[model samples]
Target: MRLHPVVSLALTGLVALATGARAESWNSVTVSWTAPGDDGMTGVASAFDLRYSTSPITAASFGSATRWTSTPAPAAPGTTQSVTVTGLLPSTTYYFAIETADEVPNWSSISNVVSRTTSPMPDAVRPAPLTVAVTSVTDSSASLGWTAVGDDSLNGTVSSYDIRYSTSPITATSWSGATQVTGEPLPAAPGTPQSCTVRGLSREVTYFFAARAVDDAGNLSALSNVPSVTTLDSMPPGPITNLSVGFVWLGWHSSLAIRPRSAEARGR
Candidate 1:
């Protein structure tokens, strides 16, 4: 069988697969068969005809199918023969067949057909990174807003959000180490305005925040834009009143207190 290099194929980056659509992949499959001879399994064949098609491939239909390229030369008659075909479509079924020829240009009959269905592609694309901003803040909590995005870059609604905050600036690399805010709402439709509030933060503390989006396929987007805010300082040093300066009579005493401040929450 003589395999040609010319084959047809198409490529597309479909991160947001439509409902019920088959997933696509970038992969290949191999086909193998025992070698046939130049003259009835007696001698090495001079050339090979290797072809594949989406439909059943037969002796008559082989010429119209896509031929595999650079097939290895036949071995001694009755030896093993194999070929790895590439550029095949993902999540597709294909049929392959072959014929053998001799130095006399005499061609043998096509071999029995073989069929294989490729695996569906994996979802490796991450959601669009969010660009979050502060919307409101109180002594113990804060609200955040950002343009909503989907599972893929502006492709479809994501499955969830991982909102995190820290006194230090947050980043994609540091996302896992930051404090995660719970009760995040399900992601909104792509391009919709979205908002969420983080609770249990300390008053009068500065906090830095960032977020990541997750897909049903478990794909995670990079961290969103980091934003910072200080919670309302409504608790501390509430107006000391009644200034009474008595003469240095009996023992006079005074006291004070302190605590580490936590920043308000921020996220996508």
Candidate 2:
């Protein structure tokens, strides 16, 4: 007796979960399909084939399309099977289909075609070098300026900057101990000079400052070179108060003597 072919193929779900993508990545999708029936014939499906491609998927496209593992037949007809497809290009649309075959080697027609686009990949590149300089200093604060760096090939714009300072040298490894400078503009424009003032500093104390750039995707760059600046002392000097002045005429030819005394001085 001639074996019957799968008469009905349908897709049950195409849930695209974000659980598999790693940091700064979006290149995965999950697909599910309902097993087709044997049209009341006496044959049962032995396996299911899943295929995908960037273009419309057809029976002829199976040879060129990316094929997933051949899943074993479901316990019974009309059952559902699911598979998670990964490592696909981000921000790209893909077409998918399913094919069922029975023990008689008769393949069913391709299932309903479905298409889905992966989420855009997150920005993974770090920003270029950021040069920080101490533009102005005072007894209680230090004004900072920096030449902003551009994003990696401008793929993503710079979101903001993380300003850090410490009494000791500032480095990438010691960033935790450094104090963060807040209130600065978030998402400073790329390739621009940004400035900010850090307050509450100690008088006559030296501080090391550094900075790093953060992209829109929250990827941070390496720490900038440590630039040191010493705050002005601005302390008042000791006061000097004294008065002592005496002048005696040395011209004795006419027997004349003169004395005058009046002296005042102040020190700060």
Candidate 2 structure lDDT: 0.74
Alpha-carbon deviation at 66 in model 1, angstroms: 2.1
- Worst 10-residue stretch by lDDT in candidate 1? 4-13
**Between which residue pairs do clashes occur in model 2?**
159-187
lDDT per residue for candidate 2 within 30-135, as digits (tens), equals: 7776665554344456777788899998777866888877445544665666777777888889888877777666777777778887778665678876788889
Clashing pairs in 1: 1-48, 1-49, 1-99, 2-48, 2-49, 24-121, 150-156, 206-263
Q: What is the TM-score of each candidate against the true structure?
A: 0.63, 0.71
lDDT of model 2 at position 229: 93
lDDT of each: 0.76, 0.74
Measured over all alpha carbons after superposition, the RMSD of each candidate to the real structure, in angstroms, is 19.1, 11.4
Once fitted onto the true fold, the runs of candidate 1 whose alpha carbons sit more than 4 angstroms away are 1-27, 36-47, 75-81, 101-107, 118-126, 191-193, 200-204, 216-222, 232-268
